[model samples]
Target: MTHKAIAFFDLDGTLLDDKSQVRPEIKVAMTQLKENNVLPVIATGRTEVEVAAIMKEANIDSDIIMNGAFIRVDGTVIFSDLYDKNLIEEVYSAARENNDAISFYNEKEIWCNEHNKFLLGAYNFIHTPVPPVNPDGYLTKPVNMLLILGQDNDNYYASKFPQLNFYRNTPFSLDTVKKTVSKGIAVKILQEKLGLTKVPSYAFGDGPNDLALFEACDIKIAMGNAVASLKEQADFITKKNTEGGIVHALKHFELI
Candidate 1:
């Protein structure tokens, strides 16, 4: 019997092009993977809405979004790790004091306290629309993640919210989640749920955040444009996303 495999991908700099578009070659490669019985799952820090727009262009659905804080397989949420109410309030207060914009994400929507130039710029960088603001609604329910845009005092935040972990996606932006949450945890859970433990699992990424993902998979692929540290740890290093790295890696491994 042949071993089944799943290809997990990080969105920015790994799967999506610089314009945030999924190129034609990538689409073809993904289709081939499915035809070959290999599943492709997107594991990223992107919100569902953000992922939805890209999926519309790329046409694949299984995803572990919000940096593994939320997991959706075929439009159904199989797992979610939400922030504690106290943690949310604490973070909200700190950002407010610093005049930094805070974006909150639930399974359904992405809301913000205020949309500043920095926040809007971050969204534009990813080609995502600016999220609506509902400051009061933030505390009303559990939030899956918080994106902080603007000045951040990392040490102060670390000491203040010791239970939460931060991933600096960009110098001006960072993501906060439960200290125990990660793409690795999501992948492990998804693999177990689907009984794919015996089969080899693969992950591709290009940043510091992808380190956990690298540690979780059987095959770790770092893109050519990936951070140097990530490339050092990769089992295989392929071309840049803009250069059709997905296709290159898939062909190199004979997944296609």
Candidate 2:
């Protein structure tokens, strides 16, 4: 069925609360959106495996995962962008030189080169456990994204490898993907693939990584707690996530 509209939501600080749990009111709002013929899609830096339970809980089937490296619509995988193994090795080496931990991600699992304070902090921030150690997983498994556990040096990596995009969503890690890949690109790809080109699109986000997502949509809604950069670009500013941001935005647009 064709939806009347589409809404893309960032997981952390937008759809999910500070504790990484979906709010009860947000769940009800999602149901209302579906009933009103609006499709809700998750646009996040997380992998498919990491969001499986959250998707089930929220009853959402579509996602732009891994910072746009993968896409799924209505339970079907439509796009997958895997990183070059050689480039992965180069980044790994660079991280090692900086004494940073690097993690490899596929749709099914995550493997890290080492367990360190940054790795633990990154996972803990998301309420997830640190991935098992498997330094060579990228050699055999397809890696769609790389997580570099570090606070600073984002620009260092960006300048060192001009072919990759680095987004530091949290203080503990940088989510790295191929250059030219972004949530915006994936939004367009999803729209074209699903014949949603004519559908009005809305995006909700709260971080720097979501700037691309905002640029891709017709309307951008920023949570009150969103970073100042994102808020500056938002068309509508809603309440804080903990204070019913999603539902308020939906109601403001009369979507719910």
The candidate scoring highest on lDDT is 2
Model 2 ranges with Cα > 4 A deviation:
none
User: Which run of 10 residues does model 2 get worst, by summed lDDT?
Assistant: 22-31
Residues 212-256 of candidate 1 have per-residue lDDT tens digits of 999999999999999999999999999988888989999999999
Q: Candidate 1, TM-score vs. the true structure?
A: 0.95
Q: Mind giving the per-residue lDDT tens digits that candidate 2 earns over 99-129?
A: 9999999888999999999999999999987
RMSD of 2: 0.8
lDDT of each: 0.86, 0.92
The residue-level lDDT of candidate 2 at 5 comes to 98
Estimate the lDDT of model 1.
0.86
lDDT of 2: 0.92
Clashes of each: 0, 0
